[model samples]
Target: MHSSAVFLIEFGAIILGLGLLGRMAGRLKFSPIPLYLLAGLAFGEGGLLPLGASEEFVAIGAEIGVILLLLMLGLEYTATDLVTNLKTQYPAGLVDGALNALPGAAMALLLGWGPVAAVVLAGVTWISSSGVIAKVLGDLGRLGNRETPVVLSILVLEDLAMAVYLPIVTALLAGAGLAAGSVTLAIALGVAGLVLFVAVRYGRLISRFVSSDDPEKLLLVVLGLTLLVAGIAQQLQVSAAVGAFLVGIALSGEVAEGAHNLLSPLRDLFAAVFFVFFGLHTDPTSIPPVLLPALALAVVTAGTKIATGYWAARRNGISAKGSWRAGGTLVARGEFSIVIAGLAVSAGIEPSLGPLATAYVLILVVIGPLTARYTEPVASWVIARRRPSGPASAPEPQAAAEESGGAHDELADTVRHDR
Candidate 1:
């Protein structure tokens, strides 16, 4: 009974705090992610007051948060859309890997951590936080923007790539032989291909089976199915979030709309818990020793990620402003980075690697929303300032309007208009 009461008090206090923080963020017109992270830090190890009873529960909630995030994101499009994106965006995924992943691998080798650790660190830097980026897109009302599909396609490719990359990393860390690792890699690829094929081919049938008139029944069924598939995917060495995403794509029309409506509030609540749970694991005292290198790494990879996004979006014919937004949206590294680093940490690969990954993620995740909101406008402002100030130096006004992405600085104008 005493333990129950403490759990209630601790968890209740957390919810209440999150609600207030969300309200403050609303009034300030910004994301609540950084605030949520700080709150978790304050209540975690080596901070002000640690939660003794509810920490475990919070971790489970965090997993649910990620599943819901991906599921809802999937529901926004159809299987056809996913297939279309896959066809047009595969090259961008290659560019993304080369630009972002190499830096981390190079850094690891430069630090003399060897090839295995290099592979692990490469993964840590390559992937962006889908959950965080999804949330930012929703918060900033960019979900309907032209560049969003480009961003989502890149994220989906990364998740698919993880199916293969993770098994190799695990095999390496376990000191498994070459043949065993090859077998695992083969299985991972086969499963990933099967999932995508099934999702695209028979999705309508799945939706028909899941469709229901009653909201309560629909909610229970969809949520239950999502968790089930997510668990099975995790067991198969696939990304649970990707599994959830497949489930979402399999539903369409009324069923999809109903599931989204029923799940939105729950998604928001658990998503906050997820961010907090992330902070709880990071011991504040461990950050300073590797802060400089981490900051330097974060800076370099951030630029690479931005460039990757810009190139991908532009290749798909997105406007300059839309490409900038797409690039900025991909800047934050969250859950996947931590997960990769955590595996390395548990294997006792390199002590400094874990801390560096932590600090790198921390810096990028905080700056993510700011960049998403301002990158285009800031870039536009800078370009405008660089232009020579004279009628003769500038082209015709009509020509300028045609060149500046459908209007003269539409991105900046949108920001100013919003303000």
Candidate 2:
């Protein structure tokens, strides 16, 4: 077979395998991310499949995936949504961001990696996957709840932070030669900020043009704008994913109804390619003794975020139950984690670390959905136990209510009066 034909055949096979696994995963209530990573591992050097695709190409595809994912994520937000949620989102987001980086930094420092590597790793943990969480919640019929808007607000905040952090961290890891100086970096940041501001300010005008009843036109508009912003962000030394997300946020005010109709199908189609390509790139045999430490680090990476998310939500007046539910639901990592890992590779991090990161990612994708599922039960238990007792001057509502309206009358009437 011709080389191009051979590549296409191999790619098709990988996609087929992932689709089957993804279906099985959905039925079994597991996130397909872990399964994809496992698939990557299976085909990697030490595992079963061992297709020798260049990590560089896979990483490129992953970047596109990140950008597309962010674009879709942005589509879910609106200007009004941003304004309303900014208050609580800022603090919670900050805490989650800090929590993500600090733990990974500590772990990397302990492990004796370089400063740049430590920062990259720490920043990786800082992200929370709104896409994954929202999808899961929506599928489970939990998206319309009182807590969802607040959770989404925080997720948006994280996306903004990711915009700043991914680029800076990527530059740092790129080392001295690849580094953009403070002035250049500042200019890039300023330009991005301006673009976003203008986009938000005049979004209404753009919405009129892009917001069509036709799904195809709406998708074309979204894709065109997405690539435009992504291009701008790249020129400014930031990740295109950030550009896509900001554009999404800008459009959030008016994009949902029409844009959703347009893009959902595309997202589903491309999402499969993204995950399968993600699996194709990760080399399983490359992980070494440090694999053990990597898993431990992964646990801390996820745990710190969970704790911080809970703390932030509680601090913001969310009920303990709601806070726990939101925090746990946000714990799963997907598109963002892989994007950051790709950034690390672009910075010349060795293949060994990539495998370790994949191992770490495997755990997050596995645990995140399960954490979301059980959050309700756990939150309910916490809420029940923490209920305030009756005041000294008044009987407890529970006890009093039970006594006054107990099932006693009905049960007493039903029972025979035995002396």
Candidate 3:
């Protein structure tokens, strides 16, 4: 077959394999990301069908996946959500994510990998895949439960961190050598500009447009603006994800439902291709003879992410059981880590370390979702066994309860909306 025909044939086969594997993953109660990667490994370079394509294509697709993923994530967030919930999640997510990721970096360095590879790998391990967690929680009817918001909060914070830090990390890895001073100044300016533009100019105007009959047109306008700002952010050497995130934040109260509706299908399709292609490109044969060390790094990823998130939740006054759930839920690393590893490999970093880190990330992505799936029952069982139940409350008092009740109501609304 001609090379082009060969490429098309392999690509079609990979997609078919992914669809079958996705069905199996659903039946097995696991996130499809890990299964997808595993399939990729089996069929990619070292396994059966080595297309021998450059890794850069997978890397690029993965990067776009993260960007669009964050963009969709940003649509769900609001300033109110952050101010109300992130106090506990942000610091905890940072500490836990860092703890989980750093050791992996150290392991890489100790094994003679370069510093950029270490940092890139570190950042990749720092994030939790909220999509996986939320799906698990919803399927189990645990979305309104006690630990749900905490998990959501941490995922939100992690996504925010990715938006802010991804560009800086990418820049450094690409050897653009961003100055700390310039980055700080740019962030300040960006925040200020966003505030002035939104609060002063667009806030009232957006309300009118939202109330207008031409909601579709309004969505197009908002999307155009979002992409424009994202372009500007890219021009400023900031992550386009950051810009898109802020735009979503600005429209949080005003145009969220519309924005999400418009963007979600696109996000899903692109994201699917991104992962499928990502798997298609990974050459399992290229993985070095460092399985022992890679496995060690994978253990660190699993242990520290779980422990740190657990500790953070405990410090936030969560029940010990809730903390455990939070930690377990946060353990999965997804597209961000893959993107980071690719960046490292591109920047003169060794392929051995990059693929090693990628390998570990795939393992965690597989395990994290399974842990999150049972968190609620496990937490409720643990907490309920430890503490006696209080007397049943009157409807009046229960209804009058603070944010907890509101959260339940919102969750109910979310379910209704989803259905």
RMSD of each: 4.9, 9.7, 5.6
lDDT score for candidate 3 against the true structure:
0.63
TM-score of each: 0.81, 0.81, 0.77
What are the lDDT scores of the predictions, listed in order? 0.77, 0.65, 0.63
Report how far residue 328 has shifted in candidate 2, in Å.
2.1
lDDT of 1 by residue, 103-131 (tens): 99999998898999999999999999876
Q: Pick the winner on lDDT between candidates 2 and 3.
A: 2
Per-residue C-alpha lDDT of model 3 across residues 1-419, encoded as one tens digit per residue = 58667667666666677688778977986677777667666655666655554344545655556566656666676655644555645676667666866786688679776776677767766776666766666565656655556666666667656655666675665566457635644674567356535744575565455433466786677667767777787677676667777766666554677667766755665566566555555567666576677677767777776777677766756665556766777777776666566556556557675567557767777777767656546765776688777984334332222214335547333322221
Runs of candidate 2 exceeding 4 Å displacement: 52-60, 176-179, 212-214, 252-256, 375-419
lDDT of 2 by residue, 163-207 (tens): 667667656765634435454467556755675676668878767
Displacement of the residue 126 alpha carbon in candidate 2, Å: 1.5
Higher-scoring candidate on TM-score, 2 or 3? 2
**Evaluation by TM-score, superior candidate among 1 and 3:** 1
Clashes of each: 0, 5, 1
Candidate 3: worst-modelled 10 consecutive residues by lDDT: 396-405
The TM-score of predicted model 3 comes to 0.77
Residue 239 miss distance in model 1 (angstroms): 4.4
The alpha-carbon lDDT assigned to residue 106 of candidate 3 equals 80
Off by over 4 Å in 1: 112-117, 130-149, 159-177, 317-326, 335-355, 377-419
lDDT of 1 at 191: 65
